[model samples]
Target: MMGRLTIRDRSLLRDGVKAIVSGDVEHLKQIVLTMGVHSGRIDHARLYGDIDDFLAKYAKLDLGSMDLGQIIEELVGLAREHRISVPKGISMLSRGVLTLEGVLAVVSPKINLLEILANRMSAEIRKDFDWIEEQKGRFRNLYESSQKGIRIPAQMSDLLRMALKGQAKVNLEVIGSEQPLASLDRMVNRLVKCILCAAMLLGSCLLCTTGMQPKLLGIPLVGMLGFIAALLMGIWVLWDMHKHK
Candidate 1:
């Protein structure tokens, strides 16, 4: 009864107990076991496995005298150790719900250090990008200053002006058949994309704050997935705009 259990087995026992307590007969019937020793009958094989010993131990327990709250706490601990998803009600059975940071503090302090390092790295990368843009702008200003007072021959200037005007008319025609609907549509699409990306980023941050279960690298899996999706979509949107521009 008291031995190491895999995530799948832990999930099975946790759900089974929840179902029993909630009177969810349908869910109890749906529980299936694919691993363990095989036998001619499924029930017989289940009885032959370590699950049988666990059930036996629980069956012998005097429920009338035992503390149900403590039992729930133990189950919750098992669920957390295995990273199995626990129901909200079961999570609230304990005195308090521990946040992700709290769990990290209990599990390992190194996880907190890693989180701080990740934050610092992202900040450094942002600073580097900003510096590059600043350098580019400085160089552009220097080049523009150097080009001042440069004069072109009148004939060449006239030809250049006419060519630019013709090109502008052509570009305007391409942008609009009869109306500015094409430009409007492009603007609307970009706006919509920006809104969606912003929402995704916001949602990702909210999910991280939730401290939901099934984490990846100490971060909520939902938040990680949301952030990754937002990043890919943002990159795609930027590339599309740059290509069109």
Candidate 2:
């Protein structure tokens, strides 16, 4: 008969689940090895060897696309291979406290669970490439300046001095870099032009309704001029959009 898991067993299972969820294979391997030794069975010696082999194989694998369920199933299989009986769908508890299976049940619902992991890996790669390119640019600048038998540029010398003294400011801005708010400024300009066009059109319509104006062909002269202005502004707005596109 299977015995209820002790507090230590529950803690080990919790750590194992945490490691699996975090994609930390090394920690999971250590946890599994500890669990195997704690079992105190003679045959568990082989389980230790199996864990080592498992770690070596997974060390080179692309874990970003691997499903968490597959790893859990592999662990369960290892237990079975070592003659360790795992109670299937059986809760040995009156309080319904969560066990390994319970945690797995909650975590295994997402079919695309590893999609976020893949995205994170991609982001990390992009950051690494960016850092490398930045370092290359700094080194190239230094090399070019040295070849000319001249002191480094004032900005570069200042930066190096500040860095060496550990007083470098984080908010330094490069002179030729594009402004962060450039897009926002363009959006605001477009919105302002739209508002001006709309105001002109509404004023023209209102002017046409008024009788107090200089008459021009049974219409107010100011109203006619207003209409012409509004039309020209509308055309200008459309032309600006087309040109930008």
Candidate 3:
């Protein structure tokens, strides 16, 4: 069930939760600032209940907690697994709590949520280092290889350009592939051509062949006619393929 929060409070909480989810440190700082400044003047019990209801309402997915004990446990667990430490914002319990740390209790399972998040943020740095090492290994292999080979296909280049342009759907009048990224591309093109060609061939054969009755499409003597007759007989095949495509 949803909590009985006022619209203004709900808006504040929604924005607050979004800031937490996005790990917006600056916004959290403001929340902490506002809360800390009013901490002494606020009704502590009511404020605590509000927090409890908020957690229960928000934590539909994760180890969402309504209690400080659960929040601490989750954070502690993450820390042990990832070898991460809590920030100074959460270190002093006697002090007014940091807004970011309050957000952390919801995001992380007690032990190392902050640490994991920090690691994720710096992943690009790690990726760059790893990429350099991999390139060095690739360079050494390329130089050592007996035969040097390279592939530069204009058709493939066009496809790559189309993909980068965010065209997930493609339609080609005719397909002529110099290079293929995957067998599926060739397979699809081949299937298309084969279907068209087969339809043509079937119609051609019906010219010499005679006396096959036209049942469904209501045409006269089937095999006596050419392409139209064959196509009429197997129009459903083309239709089904078209539907799937």
- Best-matching candidate per lDDT: 2
Candidate rank order under lDDT: 2, 1, 3
Best by TM-score: 2
Task: Give me the overall lDDT of model 2.
Answer: 0.63
Local accuracy of candidate 3 as per-residue lDDT tens digits, 1-245? 12244555444434544454555545533443342323133333334344444344435634232333334344333333333343333333213223445566578647444345435545744665777788999988987672444343665788899899997586673233323545577568657766775776666565444444563344333433545644564675566556756
What is the C-alpha lDDT profile of model 1 across 37-85, one tens digit per residue?
Answer: 2333233232334333334445555434333444456545543433344
Cα error of candidate 1 at position 226, Å = 0.8
Model 3 TM-score? 0.18
Ranking by TM-score: 2, 1, 3
Per-prediction tally of clashes: 0, 0, 14
Alpha-carbon RMSD, candidate 1: 33.5
Better model by lDDT, 1 or 3? 1
RMSD of each: 33.5, 22.7, 22.5
Cα misplacement distance, residue 230 of candidate 3 (Å): 6.7
Runs in model 2 deviating more than 4 A are 1-171, 174-180
Quote model 1's TM-score.
0.28
Clashes of 3: 14
Tell me the tens digit of each residue's lDDT in model 2 across 105-146: 578844344455446655765776877788999999999978
Q: List the lowest-lDDT window of 10 residues for candidate 2.
A: 89-98
